[model samples]
Target: MNLNQLKYFLAIVKTGSFSNAADDMYISQSSMSKQIKALETELGVDLFKREHSKVYLTEIGAEFAKYAEMTIKQHNDMLLYLDEFATKKSNTIRFGSIPVVSSYGISAQIAQFTTNYKPDVNVVIDMHETNQQEVMKELFDGAIDIALIRTDYLDEVDVFDCIPYKKDIFVLVCNQNHPLSTKEAVSLNDLIKYPLSLLDTSSVIYTIVMKAFERHGIEKKTKCLTTRHKILMEILQTAPNISLLPLSLVDLTLFPHLCTVPLVEELTSDVALIKLKKRRLNKITKDFWIYWQKYFQMQ
Candidate 1:
């Protein structure tokens, strides 16, 4: 019935065990169990089925969990709103971005947004590893106001509204001394000559690249498949390998020894600003969304 009880319930569900949840919440197992028992008594339902070594949420518990999560989120948001009112500041806009968007130009845009909005508003940005599903979960949980993610990953079940912010073209990046560095445009066939180092298939850029190869019937193999951008860049620097990256992510200024060329076969991904469809935007978040739209339009 209380926020603490709800927290314990959610923790137990997430960690899948009372003891583990207790450890994560920095509480004793007995206290955690007592809280859950009290919660079950208040709700008049057995929330969990305790077995030998594991705990499973009862059917009713699973149904109650949805409401419990919403209640806790609303409670936290109310506290934040009151705190902002007391401080005489506009509401904070919590923004989330996948690594690709964060690296593209979101940081600079955020800086400009803060500068323009001044002391009236606060903007907080969290960079996430590229996982659209995780990002959508955070959005739904009210952890972030908006997310910058690739549109290709958006699914029907996400139930979020999105505005296309930018299109990032896939480019072949390599050491300046590499053979294809000076080429005006390289095809999938031309790229076969060099060993490829690619971001893992989970990345939208990788998907686009692979689909392009498949569409063109170009059979290719990668010398390296990594999830880390820095590691991929390191491989490019040390070896005569080419990697596909979004044009915006290829900062020649930072990697002066490397160069990027357009793919003869056009391949690109759309990055969008996504938010829960039913969530209302506050003044700060609204202003930020508008600013981002204008900024990208100008670009």
Candidate 2:
């Protein structure tokens, strides 16, 4: 019925007597007999037949003995499996990032780390990209071990410890034939005149752009708000609507019709590696954080 009871039953079968089994198991004979009695009561069958001075398994007890040994073996195997799973999980670093990691060469930086660092053992790095807000959320919730995110929201969260990596400039993106596309630089005033294609409210750029406009007492017009870069590009290529995007995300070759115009105000945001201050990291994640900290300082 239970592992301990099963173990006791098998011990008696192996030693051929309850008294000898109790001695091998370091339990009193009465306790061992009581356990076997309880197991037999639960199963509604006698497991042992007693002769003058020896014990033998009943027909039903021999069959149950095989299952009892198998159950113990399976329980031990499960324990081993869980232990191995925990070890592998600890060895893997769950890294979260904003969508522009590849655009800004951060992915290359990570690749360099994996190749150059001489860890005692091979460490697995699992990384994924999401919007900035979600990256921050996952880091705080312990869903991710570390994150690459914009510093826009970092200042507001007191619990974060971050290493500043690089500054990315914001630019105006529009189709080549759009009115502002020919301008060398555009201003907030020049931008508000045309309908804007803004990122979803969850994005760091949206938060910063909206704040910048509100601070300047400008009410901007919106053509569409989206979370997908492809959708934003499609809208930009077909319409006069313009979007403010990080310089790293603007690939002129990929979208030949889209051209980037510098912002006259020179708005910029810092990208950084961040982790929750109170969260205790495993050895691999801790080494990753420390390595990047020193790496950024040298840069």
Candidate 3:
């Protein structure tokens, strides 16, 4: 049952001599002899029969020897396995932030984090299609480890440390060939007549755009086309539809034909690095925060 008992049995088997086994273990020959005696008594079996100074394993001893060697190997293997797993668990930092940060080549800065101890950390990017308020809510509820969301949204939600990452400009998008695209400066009234197909009602953009319409009392049948990026682009390019989306989604390389005229309005979101007020962050989390600061501050 005890490890010491099994260890002594194995040592004697390997050395084939009690004196040599005692020397290998750096213990007295008498201590080694006592351990073997204790094991033999507990198992109720004669482990070795000495004949003319030649030590040989008895039939029962040989059978128990197999179990003893296996037990000792398993004990050592378990310690090695735990050491490896502990390193992995410690290096794994469960953090999640929105694409609002990851989309802007912030991943490059995140990729630069290096630790002398672990050196590698796994940062989980949680880019969901929910509103900024909802994203912050998740961070508050411990659903997400960390979140990159508009700071304004967190005003109502109960939260903690918020590092101001950067500021993002709100851009109005329309088809390159659409009528509004040619205008010098389109007003909110100009977009009212056209059936507006903006971001989904669940998106952060939707919340901001709805507030403007409500403030102005602009009455129109706004089409909330909650579709994928590809589908939304198709609808915007083909029909007289206007929408406001994150500037990051506009890939000039892919959608060069799309026309983007600034809204000429004071509509901007303060992107922030946010985490819960109560939960404690580990070393990996701290390292990521450091990378984030450099990422937003750099050229």
In order, candidate lDDTs are 0.78, 0.81, 0.65
Residue clash pairs of candidate 1? none
- Which regions of candidate 2 deviate over 4 angstroms? 1-85
- In candidate 3, the residue pairs with backbone N, CA or C atoms under 3 Å apart (3 or more residues apart, or in different chains) clash, namely none
Which ranges in model 1 have alpha carbons more than 4 Å from their true place? 1-90, 101-103, 118-133, 294-299
Clashing pairs in 2: none
Top model number, lDDT: 2
Candidate with the larger TM-score of 2 and 3: 2
- Tell me model 3's lDDT, rounded to 2 decimals: 0.65
- lDDT of candidate 1 over 61-166, digit per residue (tens): 9999999988876775675566456433345676776776557666777777777676844555444555554565567556677898888656663677677877
lDDT (C-alpha) at residue 87 in model 3: 51
| Per-prediction backbone clash count | 0, 0, 0
Q: Against the true structure, candidate 1 has what lDDT? A: 0.78
- Per-residue lDDT of candidate 2, residues 1-299 (tens digit): 78879878887897799898886566899999899999989999989999976889999999999999777766654643453458776567789988877777877878887787676667688889988766765664356878988887665467778898788898999999998888888899997678889889878888888888888899876779998666788789989888988887787777899998998887888888888776666766788898888888898
